[model samples]
Target: MGGKVVFKEYDPDQLTFLPYKLEELVPQGHPVRIVSKVVDQVDVKPINRKYKGGGASSFHPRLMLKLLIYGYLTNTYSSRKLEEQAQQNVHFMWLLGMKKPDHNTINRFRSEKLSGVLKQFFSQIVQLLVAEGIVSLKEAVFTDGTKIESAANRYTFVWGKSIKHNKEKIKSQLDELWKYAQTLAGEERLDTSPTTFTEVNAERVKQTIASINAALAEQEDVDPKVKQKLKYAQKHWTENLKKYDQQEKLLGERNSYSKTDPDATFMRMKEDHMLNGQLKPAYNLQISTQEQFILNYSLHQTSTDYQTLPSHIDGYEALYDTLPKAVVADAGYGSDENYCILEQKGIEAYIKYNIFDKEQKEGIKDFSNDSLHYNQQENYLTCPMGQRMQHIGDGQRITTSGYVQIVSRYQAANCHNCPMRGVCHRSAGNRVVEINHSLRKHKQAAKERLNTDQGIKYRKRRPADVEPVFAQLKHNHGFRRFLLKGMSKTEVEIGLLSIAHNLRKWKA
Candidate 1:
């Protein structure tokens, strides 16, 4: 009581002044704050102008972009839902600076400027992250391709088999009918007068007309399972069926059609049933993951992973100055051309080439590690017959292993008389077989990777690091199907997905 004594009357409705510092309601350490801080470094000035000059005083481009990205992370891609969230949700409100951007604006921004603005935005974010030391280019990267179905229905497929079979049957029937008519006309001597062949001619001509009409109209019965078969057949028959009575003039033309989306293709990945369900014309989404960040993405019509390697490498190199130290991919991307591209680019790639037992099957004892035939750089195998089979062929007499495959071009006279022809030479002449020796460059690279613990460990990291990326995209991000059409549009959409993926990684 000696120091201080205070007496206060507290009223529930009375106004009172309190001393306190006004600070941000949102925490600085939140994931949203981290994302915002990272995105703040992105220069949105130029891109924002594309949606400028509007009288409605539209929402800030940077804020809208951030919110859209947030939507992607939360799996809320619907523009209407985003609009509602902006108005009601506190987190979205803060991220968007409390501007309630209409659904139309959000839709237009993504659809229109997505190709250029969003792509550059993503690149800039990646560059910023790289500069911040979050991603190490030297560590490892996994490149993979996944199928994103289109917005169209799967009922619109054009099967080559159905189309081919129908065309062949029509042609066969038309040929038989024409031959019979020609034989009857010649036997009746109808060339001279209508009366001479009139008795037989009237009935035959009517029969021929009916037969031709039936054949022409038979397209209606074309395979319903084949999307464009009916349409193609109808078009051909309507145009090419000269006069119904003129059976000789009937000419068969083969064509195909697509019902749902004309551009869609029937993709085959091993057996028929693997991708069996209904499918639309889809784009292969190619992503480059660096340190768990999807740096760049591109969409291609390539049905296989083989074709995506060159383009993905080229695109990644173009965006980020150099190629990744190691590009890991599934067996689908393993090909001679891919290896050649990686080699040319000075990129060390770890793509598995065992698609069809070309490489040893998984869990098949991994005999490759134990076998002396395992040449890292040359990708060769020592056959049971003591012949060295070219694992990676250079497509010429010279093998990739720096060994020249010497072929004994002994004349037919020499090989035909060989006593061991059945065992060594199965041909009529002396056969040439392959021989392999290690190349200096290949040996060095292989030794550096396979022989060392770091290289082997990183090589094993390929599956763990990259497979989850595709899994996340497919299961969480709704990237199983594409939202846009054409390669360019699909590219834009895929790029956004990659951007969204990288942004999420950075936030995490």
Candidate 2:
């Protein structure tokens, strides 16, 4: 051993002057400080109005809001995690003022107290950005949507097709049972009137099964197969019908719904790792953004993006009491209803049709419906064969939202023995085309608006403005799946996320 060896001191338990200042513990430019500062300026009267007087002296809504917004900002969505952070993390400790509310309090505050008024709080934060000139409602509001997985079990789902098929199976079996009962004594049928199986229900099915059971009760020569079928129907069919009724009620306008979370619809997710065309229960998250800041956001049960745009714009108008001066969206949101609504609101629609880009390519529009020359005065289209196609029929199409579009059907005179017939028409008969005049006119106007210099500028900015925010939320912040269950609670979660994002950007 060497002589004169020296060692520094190490203490497991040592206490000097016990002075800890959380204010100085956190830095001046920390994001948590920004979250606390921004939320302090916004009013929470809407959330305060939700509480009734005198129930064990609750935590202040502003405090709860700060904890939640900051929690979301840091990619901590679980209430229990937020609670732990409040007790352990210095940033959270500084923001919460050393008050550690349990997970129950945090969750109840998020799910119950912040249900409806959370949107108002988000709007207030956005209004602050507007006041500071970081964003403007008059600028183009770029709308886009992405499907996020719901907080539900993926396997528990009910399909409208399956329900209808089960009912049809019941109907077919009932028809067979009735025909079998008719061969028995005719007087036994009068004991209970024959319930109509045309339009089936739980009560009707039960009545019909009862009558069949009574009719076969006294027939000693009846086939045991008939009795077995009737027994199965009595044991399972009526109850299945009742459950189907409940499921149908839950799936009002949706094609499929998750039983775990009834508000979530089955949609084809792009994040399918296996790439086998898997559908997951998810919600369509629609948001309008300006300068990468979310202006308005809405959650829809509908899977398609086109159907969600009008409602999204409506939600934006509800929040701001006015509409954006212009909207720029991708082709998914290009629909006749959307175009009409945007025109009704007097906003410039730089929306692209599904074939807007494809049709502009060389030789792509040849022999297509749009390429058919139409004389506006005569209302007849000249086909590729130079034959005049007259209108054959006109019908009305009522959209799910009750918007009516009148479709006119036109047919070519003949396609027999034409050189271009093989390429022009695929059907056996003449080429028939259906067109909506109003929809075409709207598309033409949209085309004109989308080709201008202003439209090109917005086109480039749309992806930059809206997509990075989603990328940051999903990739960086890890907000890919929701924490809450129902639409109302999940809506509040998104509102919290929006506020956190705005504040985080504002501080930056």
Candidate 3:
């Protein structure tokens, strides 16, 4: 009772000595301060140019940008939450200089004003770090990729395969109608071209349907099935073909795209909530780091990492006006196209191939063509049974991306009574093996570089340098899903995340 009676007097209305400046109140090494300092040095003229001289005044781009970046920095991703924080949080208030921007103003600024300019703004921040000795582009880049869920509906997928299937179905139906028309009106009146339905457009389909209906109109005993089928195709064939044309245009180079957000591709995400490998609408976020700071970032619709390196390097060149001297990436980026491109560009690819780990394992014997004993001078491979495989022909195949792969085919003379015939060569006749000598040469060169002392150092440094940044932003900062829709706006969201990540690293 005596201790309870000694409580200090309290008054809600009483005012005490308060700091006049927010800088004096906030700590020296706060993350908010780091974001503010980094963004303040960026030239917002690119963003400022986004707005023509308007009649109504808007918040300064610098103030809007600072709030947007600091919001992402502190895990406040929603524009509504940012507006609330700008009103209530002292750091946000100080960063905004006491100017309050509502959620609409903030979202508009982020989604529209910073649409194409955020990358430049991000590059400027990286340049400032270069100026202040915080990070470097001269260092070898550690590259990686991860899928981030798009702000698109999951069930609203438009499948390219389905589109092709339906289009072919239309062609088949049209061809069937032509045969029915020829049955009734003879071949003279219904002389349709053989290739009429092979290549079709909306207008061509409409004309063909009209011709089919006209040819059928000449008959008195046309079957009800033919008339009914012609009736439906007349109603929907042209319309369906038009929609398929639009869907194909939206697909670009992807197999599937979301109807809500046409630019987002449906990809198998590791962060699947169903845990059964469900494919979701997501973007491939490619980021490269040096000293654990994100140096460049790009978003791609492609799901695989192999198809993304060339364009990712293009983005890096766009940002810093130079390519990275060396790039270390996982085996996913290893492909014939990627290897040839890196060798062409003279960027020392510390990139591991798809078989990089398996080939290094000892004790197990591999019987693949790549493991064969090759006479380099004679361009022939010796079989395990001491039989010679002659170089027969050079076969060429092209990938979907137009990369031509030349494979040298070799055939063994005979395999009669050889003990290793079934084990080493699985063919009853003479065994034929096709080899892409260029790819093999690339793998050998990469293996040599990866086993070197410097390569060993980067091999150890890669996982530590890049994975932590992704984990920090995704797990700790809660940025796994994008807050905006469409490619341009979604890219701006990733750019902000990368900037926030680098600034937090600098603060640390």
Misplaced by over 4 Å in model 1 are 1-25, 45-57, 160-281, 355-454, 476-479
Per-residue lDDT tens digits for candidate 1, residues 192-224, read 222222122224444444543344343444334
Instruction: Please report the candidate that would top TM-score against the real structure.
Output: 3
Give the per-residue lDDT of model 2 (tens digit) for 1-508. 7799778898867776877788889988999888888889988988888899976998888899999999988889999999899999999998988899999999999999999888988888899899999999777899999999999998997999999999998988887778778867564464455534676888988988897787778889989998888888999988999999999999998899998999999998877778988888899999999989999999999988999988888888999898899999999988899999999899999999888888656534668887888788988999987999998989999988678999988999878898999889799999999888888888888888888999889988999999999998888888888888999999998998888888788778
Angstrom error of the Cα, residue 266, model 1: value is: 4.4
Question: Candidate 3: where is the Cα deviation over 4 Å?
Answer: 1-5, 16-23, 363-366
TM-score of 1: 0.64
For each candidate, give its TM-score against the true structure.
Answer: 0.64, 0.95, 0.96
Lowest summed lDDT across 10 adjacent residues in model 3 is found at 190-199
lDDT of 3 at 331: 100
Better of 2 and 3 by lDDT: 2
Off by over 4 Å in 2: 1-14, 191-196
Q: Rank the candidates by lDDT, best first.
A: 2, 3, 1
- Candidate 1, residue 307: the lDDT equals 70
Residue 225, model 2, lDDT: 90
